[model samples]
Target: MRVFVAGATGVIGSRLVPLLLSTGHDVIGLARSQDAGAGLERLGADVVHADALDHAAMRHAVRVAAPDAVVHLLTAIPARIDPRRLSRDFAQTNRLRTQGTINLVDAAAQTGAKRVITLGSASVYEPNGPDPATEDVPFWHRPPKEFIPVLDALRELEALTAEAGGLVLRVGHLYGPGTIYARNGSFLHQVQSRNVPIVGQGTGTFSFTHIDDAARAIVAALETTADGALNVVDDEPAQVGEWLPVLADLLDVPPPVHIPVQMARSAFGSWGVAFMTELRGADNTNAKRVLDWSPKYPSWRQGFEAELAHPGSP
Candidate 1:
């Protein structure tokens, strides 16, 4: 199969390209800059230089590539976490998810592409009580103000993909090489500096996906005919209090400091506090069952240790 990947130089796309190549698929990677294009070239992917937000460029590129499938991996994330900058930092990514997604889907539809695999977030799911969130669960109808745009964009992106008979992988909090959860990533730096803290009872559940595992899932999606959304999370869903200390231990840092819920809300805003206190974990049962995929690292505990050992791995 021939595949065209948007955000080909991104955290997941970078890893995914090699996997697709190794599996005997020809790849065309969309790059926004000379350096990104060069990087994809080094990976043996034919490069298409165009920003994802440029609808005309995307349509032309996809039509030129004439791939059997298109994969959307575009995202813009801040280097560091700043609760105050949430809205500003997410604005570009929101645009990418909304406008970029539409462009990619339209390009695929126009080019007669058969498969479209796009990334979605598990965070869009409403809290699912004690259970992990399945694809059937309702989305947060009334999300926090800062998150409303993000969720709205996600919904639009997923809807467009599903309507086109494409697949949407609702991935969990990613944590591996080139991601914020990496050894030298901002999250680690914050934990080492005691900047991120445990809030309230720290009971909010988090489902994690290693970069390698995520790439594997995308590769698997290429061969499967599954449509709509499927959760691509690991086996274990951990609480903030549960994972923070373990991550601190892995980083050789002191356990995270505890703050009152109100203090955390004041410091990190309502969204951040909600992440630590109310968010639910994503269940990957459908992905495993439908795509015949399983994560190599099914727990953050094992994934974090491996990441620390390797420092930087693709």
Candidate 2:
């Protein structure tokens, strides 16, 4: 199989390119910068340079690669996120998810690409829904005000992928060497500084994905005929109250402090409060069955430990 990947040097893509190559797939990666292109070349992948949002450039890149499958893992999320300015911070990423997706899908169709796979988010589901959300659950009907645009972009991305008979893998919070959950990552820094406090009850649950596991799922998706959406999360779904303390303990930091919902909203903003109190976890049953994939670190507990033990490993 010949595979073309956008966001080829990103957190997931860096890991994904190696997996794709090891699986005997000929890979061509789109790198937006010279350094990124050089990195892709070092990974034994053919490199193409193009801005995903530039329709002409992207179309030309894909046509040149003429891949059998196209995988879109493009995103521009910052290392440290400001909960108060969620929409503003995510504006460029929203465009990537929307227009970037449109350009890629159009390019794939033009070049007769047989498969299209795009990344989606577990967080886009209604935060008040069932504990472990399945593929059938509707997206957030009333998401936090600040997250409206982010959610809208995700919805559009998924709808577009589905329209193209592609698969949208709704992955959970990705944690690995270079992700936010890493030792030198923003989340760890916040925890060490006692900044990420628990809101009332801390009921919001999270389903996490190891970067390697996510990369493997993408490889599985490439080989399978499954279409539509799948929640590519690990086995365990833990609440903020459950995971935060454990993460703190693992990092040898003080456990997160608890605060009232109102205090949290005032301190961290509405989306942050919803994230700590109302967000629901996603289920991976469908992904497991459809993609024949299972996460190596079945729980965040194991993943956290492994990441800490091997600080810079993927």
lDDT score for residue 191 of model 2: 93
At residue 255, give the lDDT of candidate 2. 90
- Each candidate structure's TM-score, on Cα atoms with residue i matched to residue i, is 0.97, 0.98
Q: Which stretches of candidate 2 lie over 4 Å from their true place?
A: none
Please write out the lDDT profile of model 1 over residues 51-144, one tens digit for every residue: 7888999899999999999999999988876665577888899899889998999999999999999999987778746689899999987777
lDDT by residue (tens digit), candidate 2, 169-286: 9999999977899999999999999998889988998999998999999999999988999999999989999999999998888899999999888889999999888888999999
C-alpha positional error of residue 134 in candidate 2 after TM-score superposition, expressed in Å = 0.5
Location of the lowest summed lDDT over 10 successive residues in candidate 1: 305-314
